[model samples]
Target: MGSFEFLLDGIVRAFELIVTLNPYILSITGVSIKVSGTATLLAAMTAIPLAFALSFVQFRGRHAVITLVNTGMGLPPVFVGLFVFVMLVPAGPLGFLNRIFTPEAMIIAQYILITPIITGITLSAIKAVPEPIIETVYTLGGREKDVVLTTLLEARFGVITAVLAGLGRALAEVGAILIVGGNIAYTGSVGGIGEGLSYTRTLTTAITSETSKGDISTSIALGIILIAIYLFVNVAAGFFRRQD
Candidate 1:
């Protein structure tokens, strides 16, 4: 009974934090959106094109390339994070840019993690496109570029789904970003929310942090928002799917 009451109380306070727009909560959410959004956007830009190429072009080692992409889709986030960390450290070859422990580094980590996922899914979608579509394009004297565009049009829904899937994965990711971003927050109060507002902290990381600190309300608040955001992404995906 006591435990139940405590959970109920925590939930109520969580709602309060959400309703009142707590700065710490909003800051965390914003970082989550910004980093994931940017990384997913960049990934979509590159992955969609790459998928189209993989589907349209016949080149030496193309099968090997596809296999590599498929393998990358399952790469462990923690392992990717460690790889990025090693590269970003001052002594590493790419360390001169000094991107470690920053949002940029987090973006890079997430981009690496999701690019292959987007590419693989989109490639499968493109492959699933009917052969007649390409044949029809060629029969009409359409050029290679036209066939690519036509296939992309046919696979639009799948491409969108791929992007959303990547975004969902990015938003829910903690291990890579936590390692790369260091989950930093500002030191001083910025919005009178008691806790310092997040700088690099995100909803996933913040939930882990707050829960560890025994700040149940904050954790619950972040969780509620995270669930809501995920639902929104799913709903958007469903809506696009229904359009086909």
Candidate 2:
């Protein structure tokens, strides 16, 4: 076939796969959402509280802590993956848990990778709160807890945006998960295709694997799904910012 014909054929096949909700594609997409979604939730929980503490409390080495968090925000995903891999490998410190190459391991790696991003953004959000607003809370017989709650409410939109940012990063990430997740699929075939449901195979890793195998249709389908996820996250973030 001509080049144009080949490209058109691949697009058609990709559309078919998506329209039919191909079992393999659906499974991989589900895994991607589950791992990234869980990681984003866990990171938000840890980050928002830490952000509030950093913003409200006075403590020694606070600058150092802030610096560390800021630095972590730009950490290389591959490095984070390597760090997690070392800690989870058979001879490594947390190896007894035997989580290496598991979905749990992927979650842990992604959490570590995105926690700082969320925390840093959340910290900025809280810091952006007007001092007078906080003072007003205190002036009205509000305790420290009340002040913190008030600040959080004021920055709720920014915090939500931070969470969405983290989710977008997690969804687009491939290197970290590849290192820790092993990107392995089952050996058997289904519907005359290799391995219907992947154990640790996510959309990003599956895209790489499919493209390498010269399965252009599958790769294109997965890429489309990934882009859709990223766009959704961005739109949500924008909506929250507008509300603010």
Candidate 3:
């Protein structure tokens, strides 16, 4: 076949796989969504409050904390994966949770990987708020909670950007999830809290498997789906910002 014909054939095969809703493909996609979504939610929960505190409070080592957050922004996924793996080992303190190789473990890893990015970006956003506005709020006898809320409103767009950055990190991450969750599909026999939990398969893992198995068309299909999801997320974030 000519090069163009070969490309067309690959596209056709990928489309067939997608249309067929192959169980394996669907399973992987579902795991990816669950882990990424949970991670993002957890990161947001932790980071927002931490960022607000860092921005508004006068505490010792606050600068050090900010520096640590900035450093964490560049944390390597593989290293994070290794760290989580160790912590989840049988002798580890959290080992009793039996979370290793489960979706929850993957979520924890991704949460750790994304939380710092969110916190750092959010700190920047909060700090970008004008001192004048903060002072005015205080002058008006606004309580600390009111001051924080007003500052957040003024920096809403920046905060949203931080969230989007965290989402991007969560969605794109693979190594931490792979190591912590073992990238293994849950069989019916594995009983526990993680028994029915989605196993570690994700788009990245699916693509890796397909490529390793020489299923180029299937790998391409997963890649296309991953790209589409990322784009959709970015567009959705934009819409939310515009609404705000």
Best by TM-score: 1
1-244, model 3: which lDDT tens digit per residue? 8978876777787778678876666677788888888899889999999999998898999999999999999999999988988888888878888888888888888888899999998888888888999999989999899999998899888888888888888877878888887778655532221223236888887677667887777777778778888899889878987887
For candidate 2, report its TM-score. Answer: 0.93
Better of 1 and 3 by lDDT: 1
- Per-residue CA lDDT of model 2 for 10-89, tens digit only, reads 88988898898888888899999999999999999999999888887889988899999999999999999999999999
Candidate 3 Cα lDDT to native: 0.82
User: Each candidate's lDDT (Cα)?
Assistant: 0.91, 0.91, 0.82
Write model 1 residue lDDT over 91-115, tens digit each, in one string: 9878999988889999999999999
lDDT for residue 165 in candidate 1, whole number 0-100: 88
- When sorted by TM-score, best at the front, the candidate numbers are 1, 2, 3
Those runs of model 1 whose alpha carbons end farther than 4 Å from true positions after fitting are: 190-193, 240-244
* TM-score, model 3 to reference: 0.89
Arrange candidates by lDDT, highest first: which order? 1, 2, 3
Measured with C-alpha atoms, the lDDT of residue 30 in candidate 1 is: 91
| Clashes (candidate 2) | 0
Q: What is the TM-score of each candidate against the true structure?
A: 0.94, 0.93, 0.89
